[model samples]
Target: MPRLNAVLETALYVADMPRARAFFEEALGLSPFTADHRFTAYTVGPSVLLLFLEGETTETVILPGQMGTIPPHDGSGRVHMAFAIDAADLAGWEQTLDAHGTSIEGRTHWPKGGESLYFRDPDGHLLELATPGVWPNY
Candidate 1:
């Protein structure tokens, strides 16, 4: 059986590349490590946040014998993802989001003892800043 370790990257679809880039870079403080006409990738701790143009992502195709490409995926509707943060940093994160003019959609205290701040990105993808206890294992 193959075992999975950690999530090294996560992809989010956006309608506007420039707007998404600005939200992740200027607003969220994530530095873009690479970008092209259709996508931008930002390093988030050990993982990468990949933002791709909606239609472009759906049209991606990989040719095995030739040049490989990311498998085509749909980029419609609101998608959700969470980033883990230190428990003590929750307050600061809220302040940061406020300063960025991003409204908090909700806040939840998980039954497992974790806490989360829910918000949306420029493209309306639901994003969360959560604590380690959000899952069974951090």
Candidate 2:
């Protein structure tokens, strides 16, 4: 039997569709490979990042306020997603974010060996731009 092996897409919940679209399209240098009012999809390298708005059409959870406050919605709780980039590109990536006026949550350096910068999308879902060394054993 052939194995089911493709990682085609990953979807994220967002409070505002347009704002999410703008952040990915403008800030992250990703264009909407597909889009509509309910969902917008962007090309993130070999995979696609999709934004699904919260509402009747979709059952996405909008954290009430801030990190660690939202009650669990789908049984499994507390999740975060990250985008990995080349370690050498960190400074240039920071420049892109700064130029786009994206809000920076903070940056972290792993004593072992790695770096990451955290930020949120329009809907406040935590996102990180990380280096592979952050999880060297994985």
Question: What's the lDDT for candidate 2?
Answer: 0.74
Instruction: Report residue 123 deviation for candidate 1 (angstroms).
Output: 1.2
Q: Give the TM-score of candidate 2.
A: 0.73
Q: What does candidate 2's lDDT look like per residue over 52-98, in tens digits? A: 66652435346455643423332112346788888999999899998
Colliding pairs, model 1: none
Candidate 1 has its poorest 10 consecutive residues by lDDT at 57-66
Task: Give candidate 1's TM-score.
Answer: 0.89
Question: Model 1 clash tally?
Answer: 0
Count the clashes in each prediction: 0, 0
Error of 2 at 40 (Å): 0.9
